[model samples]
Target: METAQLQREIREFAVSAGIDKIGFTTADPFLEMKNRLRRQQESGFQSGFEKGTPDERTDPSMLMDRPESIIAIAVAYPSKMDNPPKGKKGGRRGMFCRASWGQDYHDVLREKLALLESFILERCPGARLKSMVDTGELVDRAVAERAGIGWSGKNCSIITPEFGSYVYLGEMITNIPFAPDEPIEDGCGDCTLCLDICPTGALIEGGRLNAQRCIAFLTQTKGSLPEEFRTEIGNRVYGCDTCQTICPKNKGRHNRFHAAFEPEPELAKPLLTPLLSLSNREFKERFGHMSGSWRGKNPIQRNAIYALGHFREEAAVPELVRILREDARPYMRGAAAYALGKIASDEAITALGHAETAETDAEALEEIRAAIRNIEDMQKEVPK
Candidate 1:
C-alpha cells in the first residue's frame, strides 16, 4: 500500500474509534522535545528517573524492537462545566476541577489505541505497535506538537483552538512508516493569562514550570505539602486547571468530546458533606471509573480536609473528629484533625490528645499540637 493511503486509512480508523484529533509526524522531528525530556528527568522535578540516552528516546531502532515510524494523537477535553455558586457563606463548596468531570481518560485512550493498533495490523500484516500516554517516559506533549495536532502554547501545553489546553494526548510507536504531516509553528503570541492566573506561582518564564510550586503536583504527591502551595490548592482535590481556565481559547467554547467522557452529575459538582460519609466501598463505586479514582481515596479525602481547613467550616467537625481517631490512613487522620482543630469545636482539644500521643511521627505530633493551639485561641472569642 502507498504510505499516503496507509496514513489516511489509519486516520479514518482512529476517527471511527472516537479520537477527535489525529496527527502524524516523521519519527525523529521531536528530537528537541526528547532532549528536553532528558533535561527534565535529569533536573529531578518530580519525574524520578535518569535521563534517557539519546538512543533510548530518539532512535526508533532503540525505542522499538522493530523500528519504523511515529504517530501521535490527542483527545480534546474542553471545559464548559457549570459549578454551583460559591454561595453566601463560602463554606463547604460544591464543585470539582473540570477534568474530573468525565470517565477516566486513561481507560478511554487505552481502548481506542488498542483498536487502532488492531486496524493497522489488519491492513499492514506483521506491523509491530507500542502505544503510550502520559504514563510513559516518551515526550508526549512534544509528540503532539510535532504531529501537527496542535501548537505548544506558552503555558507549555499543546493547544488546539477546538479544545484549548483541555486535551489528553497519546501516541503509537509503530513499525510502518507512513506519510507525515507538517508541524504547525507555535502560536502563543504574548498571552500570559496562564502564567498570571496560576495561584501557586508554578509557571515561570515562557515555558518553564516549577513543579514544586504546581498545585496539581501538590495534590497528588505522596507526601505532605511543601507548606506554600497547600493554600493555593484550595478546593481542588485532584488536578489543577487554573492555567487552562484562564486561557482565552478555553473560555466560552462548547465542549463536545466523546459522550462516554461526560461526568455523572454528582461527580461534576460533588458535595464535600456526602464525600465525607463515603465508605471505602462507596468511594470505589462513586469514583471507580472517574479520573479521581486513579490516586485512590487517601489523597482525595486528605484534600477534602485541606479544603475544609481553608473554609473553616464547623459543620465538618464531627466527621473530622471521627477521622482523627479512627481513619486508617495517617495522612487522612492528621489532615482531618488539623481541619477539625481549625474549626474550633470542643472535639478539637480531645482529638489532639489522641493525635499527639498515638502519632509516632514527631513531625505529625507537632502539627497536631499547633492545630490544637490555634483552635483553642479561636475558642476564646466565644461568649461565656
Candidate 2:
C-alpha cells in the first residue's frame, strides 16, 4: 500500500474510532526536548513521577528499531461538569482535576490506540508498531506539537485549536514512513494568566514548571504535604487545574467529545469528610476507576484533610480529631493535627492536647506540638 494512501485510510479510521484529532511526525530524536529535560534535571524541576530518562524519552529510535514515523492522537475531555456540586461549610467537597474526571485516560486512549494499531496491521501485515499513552517513554505533548495536533502552550500543555488544552495525548511509532504533518504555530502569545494565577507559583515563566512546587504533583505525594503548600492547595483532592482554568485559550473549550471522559459529579467533587475514614477496600470500590485514585487512598485522604483545613470547616473537626487520635498512619495523624489546628475550635484544641499526650510517632508527635503552638498563637492574636 502507498504510504500516503495508507495514512489517509488511517486518518479516516481514527475519526471513525472516536479519536478527536490525529497527526503524523517523523520519528526524529526530540533534541530540543532532551536539552530542556537536562536543564530541568539540573534545576531539580522534574516531578519524580516522570517515567523515562531524558535520552530514552526524547529518542524514538531507543524505543523502537528503525522508527520511521510517529502518529499522534488527541482525545478531548470535558472541562466543565454539568450542574457541578458546590462546596459548602458542613459538606465541603474536594476536587479531582478535569483530566481525572471520568475513566482513566490511559485506559481510554490505550483502547483507541489498540484499535488504530489493529487497523494499521490489517492494511500492512508486516508493519512494526508500538503505541503509548501518557506513561510511555516519548513525551505526549512534544509528539502532539510536532504532529500538528496542537501547539505546546505557556502552561506546559498541548493547546489544540479546536479543543483548547482540554485534551489527552497519545502516540504510536511505526516503521512505515507516513508523510509528516507540519507543526502548529505557537498560539500562546503574551499569555501570562496561567503563570500569574498559579496559587503556588509553580509555573516558572512560559512552558516551564517547577513540578516540586506544583499542587498537582504535591497532591499525589505519599508524605505529609509541605506546610508551605497546605493553604495553596485549597480543596483539590487530586490534580490542580489552575493553569488550565486560567488560560484564555481554554476559556470556552469544554470539549465533551468522548463519553468515557464525562465526569460523575459526586465522584469528581467528593464530600471531604467521608474521605477521612475510608478503608483501603472502600477507597478502591468507590474511587478505583478514576485516574486520580492511582496513588491510592492515602494521598487523597491526606489532601482531603488539607481541604477541610483550608475551608476551616468546623463540622469536620470531629472527624479530623478522630483521625489524629486513632489513625495508625503517622502521615494521616499528622495531617489531621494540621487540619484541627486550622479549625482551631475549643473542641479541636482539646482533642489536640489529648492526642499530644498519647501520640508515639516522633514526626506525628512533633506535628501535634506544632499544631498546638499554632492554635495558641492564633488565640493570642484574638483581641479579647
Candidate 3:
C-alpha cells in the first residue's frame, strides 16, 4: 500500500471510528520539548505523576525500533453539563472538573486507539505500531501540536479551533512512513486571561506551569493539602478548570461529540456531607467509573471537607466534627479540623477542644490546636 494513500484511508477510518481529529507527524526526537522538560525538572515545576524521564519522553526511537511516523488523535468532550445541579447552603456540593465529567478518558481513548490499531494491522500485516494515551511516555500535546491537530496554548493545553481545548489527546508511533501534516499556527496571541484568572497563580507566564501550585495536581495528592491553598481550592473535589474556563478561545465551544463524555449531574456535583461518610467499598461502587476517582476516595473526601469549609456551611459542622474525632486517617482528621475552624461555631469549637486532647498524631493535634486558636481569634474580633 502507498504511504500517502494509506494515510488518507486511515483518516477516513478514524472518522468512522469516532475519532474527532487525526493528524500525522514524523517520528523525529522532540528536542525542544526535551530541553523544556529538563528545565521543568531542574526548577521542580513538574508534577511527580509524570510517567517518564525527559530523554525517554522526547525520543520516540527509545519507545519503538526505527520509528518512522506518529499518528495523533483527539476526542472532544463536553465543556458544559445539561441541567447541572446547583449547590446550596445545607445541601452544599463539590464539583469534579469538566475533563473528569463522564467515564475515565483513558479507557474511552484506549478503546478508540485499539480499533484504529486493528484496522492498520489488517491493512498492512507486518506493520509495527505502538499506541498510548495520557499515561504514555510521549507527551500527547507535543505530538498533537506537531501533527497539525492543534496549537499549544498558553494554558499548557492543545487548543483546536473546532473543539477549543476540551479534547483528550492520544498518539501512536509506527514504523510506516506516513506523510506528515503541517503544524498549526500559534493562535493564543496576547491572551493573558488564563494566567490572570488562575486562583493560585499556578500559571507562570504564557506556556509554563508550576504543577506543585496547580489545584488539579494538589487534589490528587495523598497527604493533607497545604494551608496556603486550602481556601483557593474552593468547592473543587477533583481537578481545576480555571484556565480553560477563562480562555476566550474556549468560549461557546462546548463540544459534546462523544456520548461517553456526557456528565451525570449527581455524580459530577455530589453533595458534600455524604462524601465524608463513604466507606472504601461504597466510594468505589459510586465513583469507580469516573476519571476523578483514580486517587481513590481519601483525596476526594478531604477536598469535600475543604469545600464545606469554603462555603462555611453550618449544616456540615456535625459531619466535620465526626470526621475530626473518629476518622482513622490523620490527613482526614486534620482536614476536618480545618473545616470545623472555618465554620467556627460554638459546637465546632467544643468538638475541636475535645479532639485536641484525644488526638495522638502530632500533626493532627497541631491542626486541632491551630483551629481552636482560629476560632478564638475570630471570637475576639466580635463586639459584645
Cα lDDT tens digits, model 2, 236-264, are 99998889988888888989788888999
- What is the lDDT for 261 in model 3? 86
- Per-residue lDDT tens digits for candidate 1, residues 1-384, read 777798888888888888888988666645676666656556665334223554465555567776567788888765764444442243465356666768888888888899898888887888888888777656677778878888888777888867777888898988777767888876778888888888877777767777767777677666456556656778777878778777887776556667866756667656665577687788998888887677776677777787887787777777787777777666667677667666666666776777788877665666688788777687787789
Arranged by lDDT, best first: 3, 2, 1
Please give the range of 10 consecutive residues that has the lowest summed lDDT in model 2.
250-259
With candidate 3 superimposed using the best TM-score fit, by how many Å does residue 298's alpha carbon deviate from the native? 0.6
Q: After superposition, how far is residue 259 of candidate 1 from its true place, in Å?
A: 1.0
lDDT of each: 0.73, 0.93, 0.94
lDDT of 3 by residue, 311-375 (tens): 99999998888888778899889999999999998899889989988999999999999899999
Which parts of model 2 are misplaced by more than 4 Å?
A: none
Clashing pairs in 2: none
lDDT of 2: 0.93
